[model samples]
Target: MSLSETQPDAAGARRIARPVPLRESVYSAILDMIVSRNLQPGQHLVESELALMLGVSRQPVREALQWLKNDGWVDLRPGLGAYVHTPTVEEADQLLAVRRLLETESARLAAQHATEEGVEHLRELCRQGFAALEAEDVATMVALNAELHATVMRLSRNDVLVELASQVDRRVRWYYTPVARHRGAQSWTEHSALIDAIAAGDGDRAGEVMHAHTEHTRLSYLEQQNLEKSGADAGSPARPITGRRP
Candidate 1:
């Protein structure tokens, strides 16, 4: 199943499941495109075109666009339809900082609770990440990066932490996508150190490694912004959020 139904219902049925709703799947598809940069930032989202592309009708596209707007992923202009939201530096920094805090704690806890199987899993993921990096497969690298972090969070064995991570994980993927290739080899190297710390059951070392790794990603993004600013000379300014509509 695309969606995992791990929790039991009120009646306590085992692994109760349902097919993911079409609206949600469509929303995810559009969001993934945005995260992957397949749909460029600020590019207009035509409902009919999206419907045709995703093999869905216009209604789901319309609903998905609205949902994206509500979630700050897209903007629905009065007459101009929908467009992807271009993230600003301030926004990225804030979210990445939050990610660092949560993930650092997860790493610490994972080190304390690491099992043989979990450590092996982390190593397997690390190998795959290195392979992706070697093959110059940014998309697969990004996905595997997520999977590795998710595995660490799982090893933490904290349901609440996992849930919180899941909430921000999609946005993290969005922010990390640009920096994936930029941090490719170094990122995996950091992952190797983190895995070693976990395997050694050194909570402090694992926490420190994870914290540094995430901070590096954030700093790299800032460097990229600097390069972009220099390239643009007179960079098109980001639109400031306002209290009242123009």
Candidate 2:
């Protein structure tokens, strides 16, 4: 059944009652699909196919497309359907710069403000991420990594920083997914260090670690992209596809 139909009371009242709105679900689904490379960059999104895949009506998918367009995730055409937006190198650099600034501050604040419980939560998330990686569960690792970051952001207790970090985080995830598998354990090792810095209340160290971590991620993604392009230029059609990092 469709999400709207599943919420009989809300559907009857013509309202959404969940913590996450229907539009947000649609938006997230589309974003995940794109990030996971199920929908390739510059690939067209057929409305009917999306509706069927998402188990919703065309309305929500259309609404999601509009939201994605505003976020620069998709481009809407007059005659054709929506297409995944391919970010330029300059755009990627801009996003990484903003992300590094926001996340470094978040890590610093989290070091100062994180409670014991918050630290424990982050540890659990890190453990889960490691386990996911060991199991080759790339999707789970991606989700757990997001949870770890979200936990740290919440520990900072700064709403403005949280919001800004979330925006940059999403964009980074979009770029990271296609190249995550290449870097593998190195990513998780950095995450562990960030958690350790926060646990020790080392604000400056936390910030520095986070900055390096994000910078490394950005560089790795660019390198992978360049490697792929070179392979294509060399007419190597048998290059292996790498999974994205968590």
Candidate 3:
């Protein structure tokens, strides 16, 4: 349970402040690790280890695991304990398809309402993204990519769209991480075109560019998954589809 303190202010309005629940914080930490693949999919989750890793107690870890299970982030077995949920190909495809729809609409709206500042912000991000790419900084590149898309969503001025995008943000990042490097130059190039369309206030062209941009990513992810499956079937060692940072 979460506790908060309420006090009267000068105008008699109440101000309440409370720290986040420990279980909730633990849940977020574990969820992030899972999303980053630090806790690989299907990896067994040891409550004690998690407690130790997070500097918390077993009770909180246990609570967090249950919450994670409720959220489809983990699976609790009858006797085998908890494990990270391994998403199926269908799960990935469905999620990406939804993203494409939401983001395409966001792009169109952003073009309609984009300010000079917003477009410039996107250009700055693209510049940083290109720098990250050239330096082989995979983590920065992934983060900037996410930021750029999120910026576009915000520029749309559609609260519901932004909230919807936030809901799948983690999973989208999880899937994108494996293809970030593979998408590389071409991905940023698409972003430049998207920026141009939005900057020009060309809603139709912006939607078209964003549609192709997101679709390209979707296809790239699917292709990588297929390649990995083939390689696995051929008795070859698994390879990282997105090459590691140099």
Candidate 4:
């Protein structure tokens, strides 16, 4: 029943799928830690410690660290080892703007193509998100928010758009994790409107709703940065792209 045990061979016979290598698994683990802020910005990454913590060998850890460096997630100093990359305001803004563009298009497409079942599914997700909000479960709210967006992307039914969105997805999660709690009720309210537009099959309305919804998040992040700047007068620097574990 495992993915690695269920793949079909070239001749169409069943064969074990090649299991993912340890190095790739380690890479994914480290990436999750970074995205969740368990490995914070500028925090030193000790390979031996990470290997031990992850119950893996140093070889895979080393390989994963190198991969992280290539992906701009971890910085490897010439002699000082590795550290998590400190996300900048400019970087966050740029990435978020890209997400907004992609999601707006997705909303438009979803409205054009949405089925009744798909719209109902979106509404169910919206309800779950609201319930999470009511429970003040930021983690669940954040996850449900992601699922809602992903469902919209799927409903869009554009492989090219989905591919482009996939590229930006993790980065978007990294940025949004910090602001999720702050987004609160208004975020779900907007999701409701977006669902309504899709249900109505109003592509223009769907796009408009998504555009505004994404802009709210962007503005909120900017405002958060501004607040941090205000507080930095006492010498505490603004730390952008914070995360919390679910």
Q: Root-mean-square deviation of each candidate, in angstroms?
A: 8.0, 7.0, 3.9, 4.8
Better of 1 and 3 by TM-score: 3
Candidate achieving higher TM-score, 2 or 4? 4
Which scores greater on lDDT, model 1 or model 3?
3
Candidate 1 lands at a TM-score of 0.86
List where candidate 4 sits over 4 angstroms from the true fold: 1-16, 237-246
lDDT of 1 by residue, 86-183 (tens): 88889989999999999999999999998999999999999999998888888889899999999999999999999999999988888887778889
- Number of the predicted model whose lDDT against the real structure is largest: 3
What tens digits encode model 4's per-residue C-alpha lDDT throughout 1-246?
755556545435555689999999999999988877677778999999999999998999999999999999999999999999978889989989989999999999999999999999999999999998888777677778888999999999999998999898888777777788889889999999999999999999999999999999988988886787678876886564554434
Model 1: pairs clashing at backbone N, Cα or C within 3 Å: none
- State the C-alpha lDDT per candidate: 0.89, 0.84, 0.91, 0.88
**Alpha-carbon deviation at 115 in model 1, angstroms:** 0.4
Between candidates 1 and 2, the lDDT winner: 1
Model 2 ranges with Cα > 4 A deviation: 1-25, 56-60, 77-80, 236-246
TM-score on alpha carbons, each prediction: 0.86, 0.81, 0.91, 0.89
Using lDDT as the yardstick, the better of models 2 and 4 is 4
Off by over 4 Å in 3: 1-14, 240-246
Error of 3 at 69 (Å): 1.3
lDDT of 2 by residue, 210-245 (tens): 999889888987887788778889988735342433
